[model samples]
Target: MTAQNLLVELFVEELPPKALKKLGDAFASVLADQLKAQGLAPDEAVVTAYASPRRLAAHVTGVLARAEDKAVSQKLMPVSVGLDASGQPTSALLKRLGALGTDASAVAGLKRAPDGKAEALFYESVAPGAALAAGLQKALDEALAKLPIPKVMSYQLETDCELPGWTSVNFVRPAHGLVALHGSTVVPVKALGLASGNTTHGHRFEAAVSPVVLKDADSYAVTLQGDGAVIASFAERKAEIARQLAAAAAKVGGGCQPIEDDALLEEVTALVERPNVLICEFEAQFLGVPQECLILTMKANQKYFPLLDAAGKLTNKFLVVSNISPSDASAVIGGNERVVRPRLADAKFFFDQDRKKTLASRVEGLGKVVYHNKLGTQGERTERVRAIARAIGQQLGGDVLAKSADTAAQLAKTDLLTDMVGEFPELQGIMGGYYARHDGLTEDIAFAIEDHYKPRFAGDELPRNLTGVVVALADKLETLVGMFGIGNLPTGDKDPFALRRHALGIIRMLVERNLDVPLGSLLSTAIDDGFGDRFDADVQAQTHTSVATFLFERFAGTLQEQGFSAPQVSSIRFDTSVVLTDVPKRLQAVRTFAALPEAPALAAANKRIGNILKKSEGDVSATVNESALVEQAEKDLFAAMQTTVPAANAKFEAGDYTASLQALAALRAPVDAFFDGVMVNADDPALKANRLGLLKQLHDAMNRVADLSRLAT
Candidate 1:
């Protein structure tokens, strides 16, 4: 068998920019996988993916013309059934052999094998390998079927018949051409109602030739670039666009650079083939609007990159990635400038109009806006947030902080009534901040309104001020409690309310800010205090437990994701009452305790003590009588704890978790000896009770910081 490089290309109408890269990568990977699974490609085959505005392509190296033949042994039937009594073939055996394109003569060579308890007849044959054409057709079909297309389009195709009839073809886009080549030869394959050929169209308009003919699999990219006037590889096109943007920014001769957004760069790469970076500008008056507003419109609507100065302020100039490289780009620049000016003007208009009314004046409008079907309007939700925030603020700071948080929470969702937010819902909190500042409110209130939605995603920053933190906590808890009360809990990945993110955000704030408030108390206030009549008492208690459990589970997952070992994270018995602020420190202390020389013995002994106490028939009290300790091992352990437990308790109370766990290491020898020499369930009832009490004391002390038993393995 001979091996050769392979090329596959599918040309269609413009693809959805956001989904192009994923589709291309999936197509190449799945196709290569299918080929390899069929033995038509080696395990070490190299695959390259190419995608553009109008084409998806892949080049795989070291593909065989046909897969190698395989030797197969298949069980036919029970030997007893196939061969009657003696050594004669039965009618059933003859019929089975006929189905395999063989006759009675072939039964002489059949082998006998045992299947389970009974002996069975086995048929041995050599299965011929699939040719490249058939293997590639299967691979191509699988690849297309597996692509992560955002949406599919159905179009009619004209069949090649004496009387041509329209046939419908469904794909991500209308397929126009397909190219499949092995070395320099075309492979016979069909897909999307089109036969595979060695030619493809590229660049729509700028292509130097129509129906660009590919010479070979190895030369596809080079030939396409030279004659098709296109850059076939998505990565190369993206890098080229980036290089051009940087160079164009440098040519502007100021301390200015294009705003860095990877998603924007990727989308623009997919929107063009031969990227020609051109500088365009809008009026400087638009800079009076917030840079976020301007940047959002440009990237979201026009897919343009906004320029930023050394001060990180939006500049009047921006960069455009044009597909065509015209000799003089003044017209292109002017056209883009003309197109963006109105968008900037609209933003300015919205900003100016939104400031005419203070956030407080718009509070009544939220009553009409629905928040959730079960949970009243946004107005009602706002009131609940205010109550929760006030409660949190009183605990964190005094009455003064409570007043600020209440005010901030009251006006937080007012921006939803503003035209600016109506046009862009992502700017709800941000626009409210601007309006608050305009209304002569304090920066504290303004920033809190802006930051109440902070940590909206993982790795995002938390609120900058105490007021902001208090409000953010209140808002997240309200949603968590409300949704859980309604049984809208997230299942797997279908988090319509983004409950997972909300839970993680709460965990981040509690842990990072080191807030001292109990998680259970916050859920309690949100359910009972804030949402008074919304949910019944039973629902409140259940929601509190459910939300608390959800938060802790998310927190534990976060700790594990941050590189903590599973056992370490699991060591902390997280529950509704566990203070998240103390978890990181406890985990660190556990890590330190695990490294001690006596840690293994202590951990194993602690595990044994736990099991013994669990198996006790009745409740075991930690209070042990010194007079009842007859065994020398128990006496030694009690004596050791008399000195050690006090010191460890003092360290634990002082928040020196590491010191506390380390102090218990001194009892490792005594604990090991006690377990080895003394039976917890003694013959005498008093002795058993005393031993159980002593073991309970040791278990409680060892597990205060973390369950050392978890570290046993």
Candidate 2:
């Protein structure tokens, strides 16, 4: 009946750095979940997870030694089948009772319950609770089975027998120890061919003791830290590293700060049990290389955090997260500097060698490199992109913009052949910019060539200049149109070409840049220019429509993410002629109009009008014959339209969408009255056509901004 907090730890070889945090979180959560499900832990129990380079552990509070017993009801066969005609126990009933550990003597106690119109016999019993040892073992097994291990390793375990042999075991890493403690008592459980104990090893080199003997669940972290010289909690270790990094950077005393990279910080944290931040520096001569190249080389190859000055320029000084804290830190600093010098040198060498050949000369090598087997070589892809860029630039500006965009697009992918990019593919566009500047190209062209790959991922910034925008648009459009033309559409979550991202990039560029170009025209140009004569005319048309639809769908999702409601977005009818840049204005107008008091009635009336037009057989025109409207309500509605339509049309034409939608609010009363009094399907064909024509006029005037029927609930 008593409750106690529990502690569990798995000691093994170093875990995968990238997967350590996930594994630790999953282990704690799954084990606690299993305990709560089994009634061994309270509903409000607190679970704390700890992970180090060599161990994964969890502490759970309010865990019971054994779960409480529970009453269970089990359904049996129908009463008619279980009993004879006289209501006496039959052989079947006796056999069933025997299987339940009871006999016919107890059959009279069975209760009959209605199950789906038939009476069925039910047997009730009290199920015994699971003991701590068995429950913990089951929880441990389930937790291990569900861990998100990136990869598993198979290894042979050491045999206790004198004979030279080994037992094979498969796990994320080889396990040497497991510790399970309930309060201060050890819980006997087995995993990975090892029995649970209260003993676990700590820091390989700095632990004051060989193996830490945990005293209790509450004292696990404190004991580990004091005796083992290890910060057991992953969060605590990361925080300590951050604190030390800040202090070390401050001690360097040049207004220098460590580069803020969460991924690098986490990886470095996962590599050390006790972090000790140390400042080190390479030769100042290495600063001649681009800071990106040097900083990347240090961070990627050496796992060092390069410092930055106040202006955000990389300094020669960097910080290393050392595992050991030695009194004399010179050795550690000297050793790290020596190790990083060669990495920086390699980066410098690549940069210097890549600048030797101009981007123009490297353009020829792209032909040898295949971009996609079906899409042709990178050389052909560049030309396609160039054509698209030139066309787009001309529409946005004059020949000057067009020429700059063309040059940028042509040289954009040439960096794919550079030595720096060959070593680090992530530096492709970056190195291209550097090479372009070195080749004596204008800043605009160089920047365009560098930033053509801008907005590569979600939330990334778009190109800064007009020329860059043109080239970036062209590059993304080429990929989307080319991929969609070949029938390689993204299905479900499998977007191999990242077409969804490319579509979103296009949408962002149009809407955020406020580009005046129609989305349909842009897609058409991309398809026609990129795939010139490669496909039949019909196929090109279909591809254009499909790609445009895809972009609009992505746009709708983005709008919703920006806090616009689904109904608001859906109300705007997206078509080929619809300019994407105008969508935000329309959505804002719809939102404003929907808030007006008269909106609901007008929306409903518009819905009715739309339904009538959809079902009508003949062409419905807005040319209403004035004499045919005989009803007083119809005459009043017509008079109101004559006054309201002109003002709304003027506002719409002036691009004042909100005012246009607001102008229709005055007609709400007239609209409701007409809908109430008028019969659209009149007995006389001419009268019916005239009434339909008046409604058609009303519909057109009300919906120039957006389809109001979509707002009707």
How close is each model in CA RMSD to the real structure? 1.3, 1.5
lDDT of 1: 0.92
lDDT of 2 by residue, 67-150 (tens): 999898888789999999999988888888899999987788888999997999998889998899999999999999999999
Steric clash pairs (candidate 1): none
Candidate 2 wrong stretches, greater than 4 Å: 89-95, 159-165
lDDT of each: 0.92, 0.92
- Model 2 residue 446 lDDT? 86
Clashes by residue pair, model 2: none
Q: Tens digits of per-residue lDDT for model 1 on 319-384?
A: 999999889999999999999988889999999999888889889988999999999899999999
